[model samples]
Target: MEDEHKELYIKEKFNNIDYMMLKSITDCIYEAVCVIDEYGIVIVWNKSAEKLYNIAYEKIIGQNIEDFFDDAMVNNVRKTGVSIENKCHCPLKNHPVLANSMPLYIRNVFRGAVSTDRDFEELSRLYSELENANSKLIFLENQVKKNLGIFGNIIGKSSSIVKKIDMARQIAPTNSSVMITGESGTGKEVFAKGIHELSGRKGLFVPVNCSAIPSELFESEFFGYCSGAFTGANRKGKIGIFELANEGTVFLDEIGDMPLSMQAKLLRVLQEREIIRVGGEKSIKLNLRVISATNKSLQEMVKTNKFREDLYYRLNVVEINLPPLRDRKEDIPLFIDHFIKEFSEKNSKNIIKIHGEVMNILNQYKWPGNIRELMNVIEHIVVTNKNGIIQKNSIPEYILLHMKENEFFKEYPLDLTRAIRELEIENIKKALKITKNNKSKAAKLLNIPRGTLYHKIDEYKIKKL
Candidate 1:
């Protein structure tokens, strides 16, 4: 009987040990586990629960479960008395966590609850990363819009100018050579600079004037000469313009005037993607975009043998033709206003008003020099004229000469009987010349309505200058 009792006691002890082992395994696997009794007093707590709540089991074992949770959570668990699972974010804790709880039951009667949670730090990190990525996307979108519109150093509101700007932005990112053809004083360089700014290149913009450079120094200037390359050559080898413009844009202005020899060399560079300096045998690799501009017609020059046909073809991969001031006469008033404000500020003058007769005279004459000449005339008037207004007499002598000789003003008599008519005709011609034959702009400068200017232009039979 004694042996049997001992055996029974040993068997019972073994069963208790097995049960404790199972409990330990469950506690280790659970993330954050806690249990409460019928009175909502804490009964069990695991290692994860202790780490999450920062409270040890030994200290909180018979404590009320409501002590650790918010009032809302305690009320929810008590009222529901059913299993609950949800996600919650706590800014004060700086964490987002998943919470799960189930009601404890004894013989179908609800007792208290068991709860568990997992840290949401990783989820929060992912959300933060997504937000940052979205912000960057928004910034890039805005930048693209600016590049496509007037924000990217292009300031014209006219539809034609806007279309040209859009085209430039689209082409700027490419590696193709672009040929920009426009009359002198039409802001070709401005357009070229805009292209460079949009290209995302980190190199400098090197501008070379084909007409300005002396023919004798063409080889040395374009492809740097080594020491002793010639009598006047520098002692130390100099880098050529092509070399300086590497990894950047090289703007060749007035390309129509480039010498035949230089044209051949430029063609070789374009084809071979390399350049050899004067008096040097070694070739240097080039990675650059070529942008050439000319007021002269390259096709005509090529036919006449003044410009090389092959070189013209190579550089004409992408062509951008800027409209002449006369073609886009609508922009005249805008340009005048812009220039007036600019020059007025520079000279510290308040010459804001341009008399009607003066503007009419400016509109009638032809502008051979285009916008550049117009700007110069405005500056001259602002400097010479006083009383904050520009009158007919203040107009320069050259403009008056052109207007007086104009055929349209010949029919009107210069006598006292037709003095007003003659004076109006003369002033209108002068204004035409000053404003580059832009009627609306000339009218604005003359302070007259566009409709009236049109009537005068027709009545005078303004021989289109």
Candidate 2:
């Protein structure tokens, strides 16, 4: 009797709760919804269901869910009385969606089931966009390829610099060994990287200073080693520069300073294209391009018996001689402009320009240490100043002293006209030096027009460096 009373109470309560109102609410919502009776016939098909399935609500309301949806969860809920919550569904081909279906009860007996669905196309689109954004972030994280320009960060427009880049590009596609001869600070590694970038190789660029590696460990450093190769070795073994740069470039900097014994070992690797680890029995093949660089002359070293003749010739198959900073003085002004801007932004300084006298002094100075020295000087200058222009007083003491000692004003004629001509020649030289032999820039620095400067050059027979 009590069970019968309880069943009657539940039926009354369900009748009182208007399902029509519930259907109206679900139709206004954007998510798709469908409700069915215990016999698996659809009772409530909301407006969202019509949009999702592209079928009218009136048309699907009386239809069995099994007939339209190829057996939806409504029939299973009636038999098992278990909720099938948040299951993936595909009612139609090529249309994936998420669905939640649960058994409805009245008086603790399964009466019906209701389901809500979410579209999958929107979700997939969002996921794809997120992946694309992540890829862009990673590219930016690598410095946009070191902020490289057409010439791979080799900054200069001088004839000498242009010629060097043209030659490097020409040789980049070939597999022949290249040896770059230049001063210690003349950007040999920069050219090496540029060549590798142009080569389209699929591996990293590996650089090492042969002089810095101790003679005792040269073999292990260049040819790698096996596990437990020596008393103190990495337990997992290590890959050498040659192996690390497989299918890429291996830059051997300061190669001229390598010990005689190491030179012989390196030559064997180059000739055979294989290397045996320090203690390993098996030999590893290498498909790598070797680019050697040094300030010293390997030919002269071979003549003096400091370097092996065969090794020298092997590395010099296609030689590139990078002119010294003193010889390519026209590029100095270009370098100065680039480095000053670079260091100013790096140091968070507001320095706009250098004093005219400072520019003139820098023009006259001979940079024995090359671009590396110039970069250091600009970094210091930017860091020391708070704002405004860089004055002559801020120039380093050593540079100023060197400039004073190297002044060339006293070697001119004493006659009035000749002295005037000499002074004019000196000023013209200073302007040309400050502008890096750029006629337009020199004219601007000398406070004259380009036409006037050109006429004067012709009249005075002035030679621009």
Candidate 3:
């Protein structure tokens, strides 16, 4: 047996022609590939193999395969004349790897084996990051249960969210102004607060909703007024948001809504880094980071002469345009899970899992109101569902009406009436299966009128099984 094994290894020794051909083949392959004779001696070691294992080809080519790689694949292939592919190693390194080994036979005689390696380093990094983000999300959910005021966590791993999060993190250390643009309820305030927390700012994060402040009081609200400056003013006078937020950050929400007069004053404060009280003359030098957000487009407003172009450019030193929830549907499951757990704990309930139909509808909905709307819907379901499961009926009537109007199969071949009829049949069967064939329960879960449901059941010939 030993002699036969030695014969097989020695008989396959590379001839001059074989050596050049093997070298050329190995040199062209991008993956790390190594060949071992039946007797377990390395026959061919490519450049990629040298770099992958940090070994010199000179030292490895004539050495025994056991001197380096101890995997079972080569030996198994040599013995069984079989091949293995894409075997993932446990406890992977910085460069996670997938390996393939195949038996090499010459003239129907088992001689040696060749193995290839594929690098998974980039994939490993991405998966590692996603795991970290998910862990942090769970931690945030727990902490949110403890208190609702602390909101620093930006919980998502979608490409869209990750890009914005990376941008926020990168710009946090710098003092440049950031203009966050997105539709309403898209978590603009959350992102602003997150930036402040990451910025190492000692002062508070003061948020001013420009639209909420009355135009007449905009000056006093932004730049404090002296005592007795006007009737009904605070006796000792009060500092404005900018001055109060000195050494920290002033997040001006809805920057586009600031009146033209206030826009000029705000621009000066941004340029001069100072603010004068409404009635006093002395200028208070401000050391603050201004991070502003708006649902409206300042660029278009500038074209219309409603917003100052210079101020727009000033605030937009670094722009972060947050994608709407509909754009990153991949993050919906994460957000839904977070909100459900959060609201469940908040309401002291065990409720979990939205109805399948409702979830499908939600995932399909274009969330015009964004995250805030999603949060509100989850809260309503948690509060209303004492039965522990949120049924389709738990959804607000308006949303249900919209879902009906959209009619999932509107683009199909059938007309609206036929499409709706088929949808009802499919849903009835699904609801029955989900409810374990309980007719009354399934009807209730489907949110259909009981009389109408019975008529459909008879019309469609739906059975419990």
For this target, which candidate reaches the highest lDDT against the unseen true structure?
Answer: 3
1-465 per-residue lDDT for model 3 (tens digits): 254554454345753345657778897898888888888887777888777767887776666777765654665677687898887642123445677889988678777898887666544446635643454456457646755333238877889989999999999999999999999978888899899989998876777789899878988988878768899997656667787688989899999998999899889889999888877877888899999999998899999999999999999999999999999898787788888888788679897456777777678878889988988887887888878888878888878778666654233435888888877887898788888988788879999877877898889988756
Residue-wise C-alpha lDDT for candidate 2, range 1-465, written one tens digit per residue: 244553354345357677568778988988888877777767677898889889896566666677787756656666677888777778788888887788987688767887888787765446535643453355345535655331238877778778998999999999888999888888898898888989988866777889999989988888877669999997756667676676888999999889998889888999999988788887888999999999998888998999999988888889888877777767778887887778777667777778877777777778788888877777777788866688887778888888766662144576889988877787888889877899998888888989999998999998858
Question: In terms of TM-score, which candidate is stronger, 1 or 2?
Answer: 2
lDDT of each: 0.73, 0.78, 0.79
Off by over 4 Å in 2: 1-152, 408-465
* Model 2 worst lDDT window (10 residues): 143-152
Per-prediction TM-score to the true structure, in the order listed: 0.53, 0.57, 0.57
> What does the lDDT come to for candidate 3?
0.79
Worst 10 residues of 3 by lDDT: 88-97
RMSD in angstroms, candidate 1?
21.7
Per-residue alpha-carbon lDDT of candidate 1 for residues 245-321, written as tens digits (9 for 90 to 100) = 77888899999888898788789888998888788887888888899999999999988998888899899999998
Once model 1 is optimally superposed onto the true structure by TM-score, how far is the C-alpha of residue 16 displaced, in angstroms?
Answer: 79
Give the clashing residue pairs of candidate 2, or none. Answer: none
TM-score of 3: 0.57
